[model samples]
Target: MAINSLKRLALLGSVAIGLALPARAQDSGPLLDLLVKKGIVNDQEAEDIRAALVKDFAANTSAGKLNLSPALTEFALSGDMRLREQFETQRTIAVPGTASVANERERVRLRFRLNGDLKLQSGWGAGFSLQTAQNADSANQTLDNIGTNYGIYLARAYVSYQPSLNWFFTGGKFKNPFFTTDLVWDADINPQGFAETHTTFLNGKDTFEVRAGQLVMKDNAEAIAAGAAPTTGVDAWLFDQQLVYTKWFGAENLSDVLFAPGFMFYNASTITSQVSGTNKEQAYNGSTKYLKIVTLPGEVNFANIYGTGTQLKTYWDFTYNTAANDRAHQSVANGGYGLPATTNKGAMSWLVGLGYGYGQGKNKGDYSLKADYRQTGISALDPNITDSDFAFNRLNQKGYKFSGSYNLTDFASLTVTYFITSRLNDSINTKAPALAADPTLSDLNSTNTLQVDLNVKF
Candidate 1:
């Protein structure tokens, strides 16, 4: 009997090791259980054998040999990919001796992103991501260049700490921390700076939160000449703050309202054209220092509408640039676009939207439909950071956007979006022409865009 038990133990050890290489330690449970049931080993002995098997397996597996830092309690990886078909058409109004012209374009684009997160003890974490595009406002890469390999960029790298349940802090280039819409800020922009957030619950269900950020827009160094003193330029910065409130309604808390009001202040010098014999240089458009904006964005959501698993959502966004200066662009001599003062009334923008859906586009058979109308003033928001698909990212525009999305599977979805837009002020030319003879200065007559996308998430 003693000899038989020893042989049984040896066989079990071999089986455990073999299974552990490609499987987890739990995979050896059945063999251990059978040995104990047949009286080849007692429960205590079986337990001891199981522990030994696990230890041996750990020492032999790649994960166990990784020598990961003890500070890292958990790690996770996730990402998504998107394929798109895009169509765009733009009409340029006729100038004095020119005829109106329409330009149409079609293209295929792709985007991919990968993200990694590491969690450590003491409420501290770090994250990083890689994406396919270099543009701050876009992640899509045109499938051109004769099939050349795409470039990948570091999209996000940040460290976060949550000292307590109600407070959080983050530093480095990270995702937008404000509750906002594309009407004022592009969705793809990751601001490089520091953010602080604090939240407090009211009535155990409702909550109020405060978020603030100090972000760097541009860094300027002094210019030195052979015989002249160093001439320094002011660095541009964006200071932002927002107040958010969420309130739940209905007995089951299936309905809710969210309101976030925000303020943005830009601190920088105005851009001016370089003189014929000077070393000074500036952007084509005037300075961002004129942008002091206030925004109000809110939404109301009703879930399980009439008990049918359908939802209804209504949302709106409004912004006003308090520091918009018409004289900034009143004349070409002042580094302006040479537009008449009356045509530069671009200090306000707004949008209203409605949406209905059977599901949140999560599972198969779930679908959603949405429509929105927006009007953007020339100086209401930063034209460089607006939605690229709308009016070709131009300001002084009004338009309607329609979209539909359906989930093909839990991890994949198909979506279609259309935009119909035209210039809000016909007198304000969309292009900032350097010379009066520049034909591109024609007013933007119309713009239409269509996009179809296949997106997969993991």
Candidate 2:
């Protein structure tokens, strides 16, 4: 055969080997050397074939560009950054008392986050995220006027064991296991805990899922010294369980008439050390209670609303306080934080939300408008987890919130939100002489907040 024809044959063989073999096993040097020694190709021709094979492999394998490992089955990196301007206003409107208002404050804040996940071949995986924030409930760092250095926190870290596609277990600081809204759990709060989830596919477009978790809210060495029982080394723990059902009407999957309804039971223990004789739930400050909250939450989704690529969604979350009734009964006898004589022991809280949108704030022209109304009683919930942007994190308030967002690109968007709320209980304000004297601090008045945000994600 001619040397030129041999060189072409060697090149074709080398390219075939590169395509046939696994990415990590595609090195062509040994085969090229063998071909050179057999006299089928010269040294220069062998080197040329090796170079072409390397180029082909590089173009075909993701590991060549991303530096990914061959042993990993899946890997991903994702996150978002946000810039915000917030305005908070407090005014006492049309009240039968001396008018007192709080000075409005405007602040600028920035948030940056990065997350990575790696799934190994043995059905196990790990993931982590880092974010800028001052507390667990928020990931935003205020742009300081004094040029202070920003701070970053470990937001999430977890390892997962997936025995099958339908079952998984996670341990460490991880996202909340239960499906929820900001009405109960803050969006930014990743609880330190262990969780297990299982899903069962039912007949024809119906699915059932169950999730349970034991989360650590806080740890107190003082409680340990004080001999707090039923605690894991003096830790405040939350036990949660959720049972959810997803039903799809017709045959279009998520785009059709889809509804997800779920029931959640949450109980917190050993969160407050200063427990009264019988009112054990009334330990965490005056507003919050470490108690049991039973919630029913559901969402109804409409796709292609009004002939546009928009989805009209409506959600409702109703929570009843089993522990609050117990606390209320104890308060009358134990003389606790001024519960009204005729106050209903069975306190309940609820929120209703309506929204229209497409995508998860991903693409350009992806926009959403959402409005929510929430009414909470004083003892209905642990107010510590309430959204800080609403009513200044106050319980015993009835409020409405309006939010809208427009995506500018595939990974960037802008959002605007407004919140207004009024106090639900006027008697509680009169119970406190100082609050009754100051209208700005009174719960009977209304407050408003407005915020604008620009966000980028990858």
Candidate 3:
């Protein structure tokens, strides 16, 4: 049986080489040819290799070794949402609202998510996820031209594989490389379809894991001078790579600390061209340009926290950021182009937070105080057409939040979030006109929002 498996593997390897992957990936030639020529890797050796790969794939998923099974893997999920009440305060009245007093409103939202991993017996595993959430509307899905409590959400899916320990591959709708938390506005919503590094490192505890992959984004291509792009494909220029390391800092009885930190970079090509490695040359003929739908500039995070699996844990997280202009919209002022300059454009931003959690097993409760600040250098009039263009235009968006959650039971929990935002734009183009409308533009242009939510998880 083992000998027969070797023959099959060798034949498959030969066919694979005759197809798509880069030549070097196949070790420069087909398996049969190599074996025949080398006079090595005997049939016996081939079987050993096959068995090793099978073991490696399992180890990769459970322990990390060589091959990653292309099998279907699914995750069990259940989520529930209670009710919500909101209060908004805005001093500037569009017309005469009769009073400047803050107004309150009633609304309800459904938040639920589930994912599955399907690894076929044929060595082809696919992954899928479904998330239902209602946070304020984004610029993505909206109707009636008004940003209301209407259902506006994100749906993403992707497929991945680890053909070998040193190599991995993936394709589909997913998250971009930079930043943490898929829910840019809400952390509960996990994003998808991002290619990532599957490397391992030895740390004190369970070793450090790293993932680096391309980020697929949308819009802003023309605005950034990245001529012609696929509506739904990954932008290699926009890469997403992360590094995470977990360990038991102290003794088993003492508290433990888990630290995951790394850098982020997403380069949406402003111009089309053949990019081999780090070099980007100019391309005129219509071709695919990399694009990732994002606003927050690339960032660096040093998240440190100490806690245990039982309950009651504490964490202190520090985050540093570099400004990125909103490439979604552009004007003729910053040179008819939209991307910011290599220097004077996107400024710097950072955030620091401290928190504590209480719970047992999956049913957990927590609270925290977080402060965030980000600065954009590109003026509203800036262009994203040239390589020098900044991804985000504007300056100084700073805020603070006090949020908490109480798990009423295994199936229910209550959450409250409060935020204060302040903006400081460059006086020159601070009031620049917007090229695209915000999906959440509703009863008012701006106001402070207070939100409350209850959730059930299974």
Error of 2 at 442 (Å): 9.3
| Candidates' RMSD to native | 5.5, 6.3, 15.5
Rank ordering of all candidates by TM-score, starting from the highest: 1, 2, 3
Which of the two, 1 or 3, has more lDDT?
1
Q: Which runs in model 2 stand beyond 4 Å of their true positions?
A: 1-71, 91-97, 222-233, 251-269, 272-290, 328-336, 434-444
TM-score of each: 0.83, 0.78, 0.51
lDDT of each model, Cα atoms only?
Answer: 0.77, 0.70, 0.39
Q: What is the lDDT of residue 383 in candidate 3?
A: 18
The number of clashing residue pairs in each candidate reads 0, 0, 48
- In model 1, state the lDDT of residue 378: 69
The candidate that wins on lDDT is 1
Candidate 3 C-alpha error for residue 206, in Å = 4.3
True-structure lDDT of candidate 1: 0.77
